[model samples]
Target: MPDPIYVPVLKARQAELAALSEIQPATRKAILPVLEIAPSEVDDPQVVSDAVDRISKKLEVWGGNELIVDAGFLSAGIRLPSGQGATMYATAKARSLGIGAIPVARLSDGDSARADVRNLQVEYDCGVAVRLSMEDMDEDPEELDSSITALLGDVSVRRDQADLILDLASVQGDIAVRGGSRIVLDVLRELEKVEQWRRVIVTSGAFPVDLSSVVPWVQSEFQRYDAALWDAIRGRRRLPRIPIYGDYSVAFPLLVSGPPFAPAPQLRYTLGDRWLFLKGRKNDPRGSEQFYEVCEQVAMHSEFAGAALGTADARIASPREHGPGNGSTWRKIGTVHHLDFVVGRITTLGEP
Candidate 1:
C-alpha cells in the first residue's frame, strides 16, 4: 500500500515534539546543590558532618534527593546562601560534610540569570576540560621519580573507584572502545548503548530502563532494567555516521556532579575497564588524525588542565586499533591524546 505524501514530515514533527515533550516538566525547575553555609570557625569534621546530616534531612523535606558536602567547594568557587565563608576539606572530610542542593520549582520564571545558569549547566556538563590535581611525590630526586610513579598509580586507583565515586557525584560513565577487535566499531556500538543508557539516567524516575536488554555488550543475569529504553532511543535521532571519519565533530561528553542534578557521568568512568579495548596503531602517523580532531573539539569547548596533544612527537597515550566490523580489515593503532577531562563545570541545569 502507498503511504500518504505527508507521512515523512509528520513523522519528523512527531519526533521533534517527543524530544520537546520530554523536556517541559523539568524545564523550569532548578536543581541546586543544597549546601551548609558555615562560619570559618566551624572547620571541624564532626561539626561539618552533623551540619550535612541536618541539610540532608531538610532537603528531603523540601523534595531534594541528592547532597554533596565536600570541602572542595569551600575554597573553590561556590556561592554560599550569602556572606558565609569556609575552607575546603579532603574527600574524607568532604564526604563527611554535605554539599549541593535540589530546588523543586514548577516553571521557569524567565529570569535572565537563572536562564544563564541553565545554559552553563548544559555547557559544562558535557564539555571536557584538562583537570589537574597535585599529589605528593618524594622529598628527594631519587624518591621524586618513585613519587611520580606512585602518583600515576593513583590514576589507576581513581579509575577503579570511578563508579562508586562518580555515582555519588551523580555521573554515569561512557563506554570507551579498547582491545584487539574492531575498536572504532566497538566504540560506536558502545556509544549507541551509551545514548540508550542516557535515557535511563535522566528519565529513570519517570521511566524504568534496562540497558542490558538493549546492549548486547552487557551480560549480567540478575540486573533488572527497563526495556522501554530501547524503544525511546530507536524513536530518537540516529547519527548518520557510525564509524564517523573525516572532519566530523561531536559534542564533548560530560559527567554530572551527582544524582538529581546532572544528566550523565564522564566518558572516562563510563568507559571503565574497557579502556584497554582499542589497540594502538603506531605505524601510521596519519592514523591519529581522527583522534586529534576529537582532541581539538574538546579544546575548543573545554578548559583542559594539562592536555598532551600540544606536541606531535608525544607517544600514544592509550593506543588501540579496529578491524572486521565494517568493510576492509585495516589495522590502525593510535593513542588517546592523554588528558583528564573534568566534568560538572556546568552551572545551570535543564536546558537544550
Candidate 2:
C-alpha cells in the first residue's frame, strides 16, 4: 500500500498517462508544419505578403492544416528589424486564408524580438499563440524559473495557454548530449515546484545530433524521477508514470543537410567543432532535399512525427559540427529549394 499522502499524485499521473495514450494519435494528426522564411525574402512588403500567400497554399495542398511560421526571419527585413512586424503579418495572413498560424519567438536570439513582459502582453492581446523558446535559460534553473514565473504572472494564463518550448540543442557542456538530459530534468523539476505546466514542448537541432536521442532520454528521466519520488513517499519501491504533460518536436537548420535514407550517424562531435565532409554523393550540395530525407527517417523510428521543423532561414551562426575525423578544411553549405517535399514527408508520417 502507498502512503496516503502521495497516493493522489500517483493516481493523477496514471490517469494522465492513460489519457495521453488515447490522444497520442490525434496529437500527431494536428502537427503544424513549420516554414522558415529567409531574411532576404522579407525585404519588400509585397515579397513578405507573397511568401505568406505561397505558404498558405502549400499548407492547403498538404491537407489544409494549420502551420507554424518561425518569426525569426523577420529580423532581417528592412522595415521590421525587430521581427514583430513579420510575426503580425504572418498571423494576419494565415487568418485571411482561413487557417491557423502560430508564431514562434526565440527570447535569446539577439536577432529575435526580446520577449519581455510587455511584448508578451501585446501577444496575448492580439490573440496570438506564441511559442517562447527557453534554450538560453536551461543552464540556470533558478533564473529560468524566475523568468518564466514573471512572464506567466504578467499574463496570468495557465501553462497550456502559453506555448513554452525548451530547446535541448542549446545546452552546453563537455558531453552536451548527455548533459542535456540533466539540464532538461532539472528545468522540468523546477517548473513542477511552482506549478505543473504540463503542456511545455521540447525541440532539438537536426545536426550533430538527432531529436530522437534527446526526447527518449527526457521521457526516461521523468519516469525514473517520478518513481523515486513516489517510493520515498510510499515507503516502498515501485514504478510510476510521468506526471507532466509536455511533448517534443524536431527542428532542422536550413543550412544543414544530408542523405534522406542514411541513418543519423552517431553525433559525437562537440559544439563549436567545425568539419568538412560529404555524407551523400560527392559534390552534391547538402540542403533541404537531404533534410526531408532525414526527417522521414526520424519520423519512422519515433512514435510520431515531430510537431514542427525549425525551418527558420538563418545561417549556422555558430559551429554545430566537428571537423572530419582526419582533420579537413571547412566549406559553406546551402539551403533547400523544395520545402514541399519536407511537408509531404511529415504528412505521410502523421497518417495512421
Candidate 3:
C-alpha cells in the first residue's frame, strides 16, 4: 500500500502528465544548494539538526522551493556506516518542514540500482521520490538505455509510486565543449522513443566550466554552443510538454524564451575575488593573469555582453609528500587551490 500522503502527490503528478501538452512555459529563478554532510555528523542528532537548519535557511532564501538532497555523495552504497542512510534522514527532515524532497539514487550496479528502488518503495511507502543522476549512467550508451528502460518497467510493474527526476548535468556536458551538446541531444532523442516514461522531469542545460583553463577567444563559442542546443530543443516543439530546468551556473532560464541574460552581480563579484585570491597563491602569476584576460574576453563577448565573470572557487587539503622518503618520511605541508563550480537549481515548470 502507498503512504496516504504520497497518494495525493502521485495523483497530482498523474494529472499533470495528462495535461503536459497544455502547460505554459513559466520562468522563475531559484537557488538549490546540494548539502554535503559528513558521516560522523550523521549519527549525532544535534549535528544533523544544525546541518538541516542551515540547509533550510538556504531554501527559505529561495522562498521555500523544493530541496534536492543528493545521497550519492554520502557513500558508495547509499548507506552510512550505521547501515541507515543519510538520504532517509534528509527526506524526513524536508517533509517535516512541509517542503518536498528529491533524493538522488547513486548505485553501482544494475542489480543494486533495482534493489535500491525497491527498498525505497518499501521503506518510505509514502512521499517516495528518487532521482537518477546522469553522472551515474553507464558509459556504454546501449547499456544505459536498456538499464533505464528496465528500471522504469520495474517501477510501473511494482507500483512503487515514486516520482523519477532525471538530473541531466552529466548528459548535457561542459558548455565549453561541442560534443556534449550533441550527446545530450542524442540521449533525448533516444528517450523520446520510450512512451511510458515521457512524463519524467528532465534537467536541461550544462554546468559552467572553470575559467582558468578556458581560452579567451573561445568564450563566445561556449555561449553559442549552449544557445544552439537550447534552440534545437525548442524547435522540436517540446518546451512546456517535456519540461526543462535551467542551471544557475549559466543564469539562463529553462528555455530560451527571451534574450540572453547574465548571472547575478553578486555571483560575479564573489567569483572574481575567488579567482584573484587563487592567483595570489600561485607560484606563476602569469597563468593567473592569462585566466583573467580570458574572463575579460568572455565578458566582452557579444553573446555574453554584460555578463559577469562566473568562475568557481575550489581548494584541496593535503601534504605535498606521502610514504617513506630517504631515512624518514618527508612531508611538505600545504593545500592546493583549484577552481570549480557547482550548478545550482533544478527549475521545473511545476513542483517536482
Between prediction 2 and prediction 3, which has the larger lDDT?
A: 2
Task: Write down the TM-score for model 2.
Answer: 0.46
Candidate 3 yields a Cα-based lDDT of: 0.34
Give lDDT per model, in order. 0.21, 0.35, 0.34
Superposed model 3: Cα runs more than 4 Å off: 1-65, 78-83, 107-142, 149-178, 198-228, 236-243, 248-352
Report the C-alpha displacement of residue 169, candidate 1, in angstroms: 18
Residue 302 Cα positional deviation in candidate 1, in Å, after optimal superposition: 33
| C-alpha RMSD values across all candidates | 23.5, 14.7, 14.7
How does candidate 1 score on lDDT?
0.21
Better candidate by lDDT, 1 or 2: 2
Instruction: Please provide TM-scores, in order, for all candidate models, with all chains considered together.
Output: 0.19, 0.46, 0.45
In the predicted model 2, the residue pairs found to clash are 251-310, 260-293, 273-321, 274-323, 275-323, 288-336
Among the numbered candidates, top lDDT falls to 2
